[model samples]
Target chain A: MQATESVIYNRAGQRVVSPEYLLFEAPRTKHFMTGSEAVKEAVRRASVDASVSYPITPQSEAAHLIGELWVEGYVGVYFRGESEFGVMSEIAGCAMAGARTITTTSGPGTLRAFENFPMWAGTRIPVQLVLMARGVNSPLSIQPDNLEVGFLLDTGCMIWYAENAQDLFDMILAGFVVAEQPDVHVPVITVVDGFFVSHTREAIMLPPDDIALPPYNPYRAPMPVIDAEVPPGRFLRDPFVMKSNYISYATHASWQWEVRSAIERSRPYAKRYLKGLIEEFGDPSAELVFVACGTAAAQAKEAVRLLEDEGIKARVVKLKTIRPFPVEELKGAVKNAKYIFVPEFNVVGWLEREVRRYLYGHSDAEVIGSPRVAGGMTMPAEVIVQEVLKLTGKEVKHVL
Target chain B: MMRKRVNIRMPALGGQGAVTAAHIIATAADYEGYYAVSNPFFGAEKRMAPAESYARIGLEPIFDRGEVVYPDVIMVFHPQVITMGKSYTMPFYSGIKRKGLIIINTEEDLLTDEDKERLESLDVKVLNFPATKLAIDIAGTELSTNMAMIGALFGAIGCVGLDAIEEGIKSRFLKKFVASGGTASLDSALERKFKKKLELIEKNLNTAKGAYDLAQRWAGEQGLEPFLPPPPKKVTV
Candidate 1:
């Protein structure tokens, strides 16, 4: 992909925004902050209009930190909704009202907010969602279960994962840019592991002061005006819209079709931002490439380093974007590689399923190692090392 | 002196502020130009439940977010964790690496004959301090024991500097002073525990100094190695 100049704009579609929407580069500061804290500050840097809060562990620190920022006058609007369902509904309403809204949730909460996922997409309202990955009450467990992620794969929203706090900050920043695009408006679910990324502390560079993306400017060209600019006696939607026997079915089906095509059309924009988000590490020509995102990729980097010492040449395909899945780039990166190893934190290997779909027929699916250790369990580099050694018919030795 | 990368595991009670100490240690490591990953293994248990927090400081980004199965240093914030067998996996020095460091919060020898024998077999270095007593005597409360332990850790590993830890403390506590103007929230109980916010943080720092001085003096007498950079690997090829 050819690199484009970092051109900033004030108006997207017919909507006019503040002049500051254009490029405003400022100095960034490096801070030792947890992934959750970094994300909270990212939300502040973005100048989000309003964000709902329904605190759960791992993700609670993020909500709490954002609340602190809000109290200190750094954030615009922060509130704890009645529940996850209420929080999603409130964000939906806020987004429709041209509010740059966001919210964070985990396993069970994601399920509770299920009814509103389609609502946000069907209406084409772009709201940033911070999903701290967790198991969804799988056998009454409260650890990192990631079926919440797989369950959302078919949902109309775009998805991205952060490998570390650095990626966490950049991904969310770009997530807003990609989601709020006039032609491809859709909510983006940004994921981080429950405890791994959410709770762990690391070095993060924050955006400089006076630098932020423009606020959400809804394009009201085709939709009804959300502002108070409608004519005093202008006729709105027909009272009995569904009773229009003929066009009702066509209108409903077309709306759903548009939601999907918008995501397809979003491929270019997603690819543009994702190019900056994705990092490919390890030997490109090796027999196996460990494909992972979020914390799993963090460990994969270390595991690849160790494997190199043992003469087992391998590489890592660190995936950042999953929804507008990086099919083309990922295919190219692993073309010479023989096997794909996907270490998932979720019980259901959603990431592996994605790998198989894009690399179908070309790559055998079974070599995609799905040695899952779920339920708040973290797969250490040693675990991956032992498994890889076992798969290569070598005597497995514990490196840790 | 520096080390390639080191894992320090601190096991304490849920309400003992070990997790915060772990974060400060990581922050200190960051200030010292190293990568650090600090995380707490918390379950559904409430206050007084055994909590294990870990910090891995290294040259590169530390990624394995798993239990420190082979910790180079283990600091026990509470003595009962060993006596009561409260640890989840690393029960005391069970997984200490060879020539590792073990710092306990008790002055009196609390380890069993079996524990001492195991330590001798592993050739691990041990540093003991009455951290709770030091906190009570200096800070007028036992809550600063974690700070005391932090001081002793500095004395032993010397991987990070004292000024870094001080800066880490300031960044963490100063925010609380500002946040106090807002609504009463998660830490209101602790806020109520301290009559004044200044007293709470000041005493904690003073307690950290007390432990640091004690460990520095005590470690010298034991002939322990000062904090130094790791020697390069000797290749046999």
Candidate 2:
């Protein structure tokens, strides 16, 4: 079966199972927690031993929380850095040493780190970082924004956005799985709403502790081994021989293909994991499907349920795994639907422009991109439903 | 039969305690052992511009977390919001269930004849309580209208009782307000001052039978029955 069909069948099978039979369900824990606190829980759950960070608005709390964890002995190492460059360097080093590492930043910090993220991807490091998003020098003052994530789309880093507090938790949990996948040994950056997810408080359901950890496969690199006796003898090298051997053009080409193939190989694993997670939560078959990530997905889900209650057949397909771009699976899930609404926290400058380009050639569905202009002020669920209803040509009631 | 879903909308604005009002209503319904969910409607609005928060209360767990379209009860905290009727109120009225109620936190005399007639024509039960005045009288400020409005709603619906609302408010707001000092005082004051409106609603319900008898007799003598208004205009967006 096609990967998408496999996902649908798996979801159907999961629906056949009762909630009582699911293992490792997230507990319905009610607490007033900011998005950063929830992300902190994911880092804790992932057993991150070290975090390197520089303080920035919105994302600063995430680093602070990690610091608290380190002080409390939750992790083995923590580093407060002076700049984004330093943080990423430390993260790469720690991850190379087999420690799960993370870094947190927003806006300018995110831009600074982007310079090195591709290098980490090229080197097959599994460093995880949180990119709390903010507006990119827009006319409006600082607030929640997603411009940076869009800019880094082709950087080979696995990227996803959190729609709300719950999504933040789920993405953090899922990020580890994506980052450490054997075939996709690439870095991951989980983007969350700067003001919405980073500052706001909402109830969340936390997965239980006893859930078995997903299998981990460490990245394999060929390290040069030297023995004292064998290494002592060396032939005097000619300049041409040294250059050809040191800069093997073939090695670079092979490694580049491996990086590309690794990302492609991660698709099936992502689909399986997302399908399992959704089945454990709610059913996803409906007439209209709303696609969003990060905190926007939370609002979209609520909007879908509201529309459904009003006798409109609607549901939400939250893209928890955005990095591998779960395109095939998403296309399959939304293929039969009449309309798809993609609400984005950022302007569709280049990133969404690319997604639209890709989606256009693949699917015939009419995809509407609703770009939110204001800073991360919460988009009322009502507004989202109304937009979806309009797209689907459904009758909507007005509140006067 | 599907039970009627009542939506209680708090006008959207910052520092207006709109979210607090929505929470109190939801908690009150839950206290009454009814399945309820309260969601705050947020948008980018200036400090004085209208914004809305909403509560969805029913016997079933609320599946919709969006804005209440056809609210059985629509509550407006700011009087100016009524003028923004073209934008906010239009959407609200389009979804109002039959025999729904519209509650405005202003004195009855403040409504123009046109405003009252238009709402009454829709078969909407309109109640204009001087909640701001009541709040000022109780707390020496005009900030407690949301609470007073909630009190009036409890009296109006009776699905959730005043005691349950009080407990909901005390447990949800007062304790927090006290600890937060000035931060929570406005919310506490609103809840406390709205008790009078609840009392008025109870009194009205108690005397409803006599009023119903008198109305019936007058209708019989006049040889007329009330006419139903045309259905509300459908909104596409």
Q: What is each candidate's DockQ, to 2 decimals?
A: 0.41, 0.06
Best by DockQ: 1
Single-chain TM-score of chain A, each candidate:
0.88, 0.78
Whole-model Cα lDDT of every candidate shown, in order: 0.75, 0.61
Identify the CAPRI category of the predicted complex in candidate 2: incorrect
- For candidate 2, write residues A1-400 as lDDT tens digits: 1223322212112121112212135344444345787877766555565788798776887788877667655556887877888888778777766666778888877777667887777767777788888866656445666778888777778776666666677766666666677667678778876766675444456654323232232423221112222332552211122555556666667767777777777666555544432211124566566677765666676676567667776777766666667666566776676666777766653434644665776766777776354454446567787777676677887442
Docking tier of model 1: it is acceptable
Candidate 1 has an lDDT of: 0.75
lDDT of 1 at B223: 79
Model 2 interface DockQ: 0.06
Question: B1-77 in candidate 2: lDDT tens per residue?
Answer: 23345666666456666777777777666666554566555345456666677776665434344356557778777
**What's the lDDT for residue A115 in model 1?**
89
Residue pair clashes in candidate 1: A134-A145, A135-A145, A144-A376, B1-B228, B1-B229, B2-B228, B2-B229
lDDT by residue (tens digit), candidate 1, B58-169? 8665776656766889998888888787787645677787778888888788887888889888888777778999989999888888888888898777656677778767
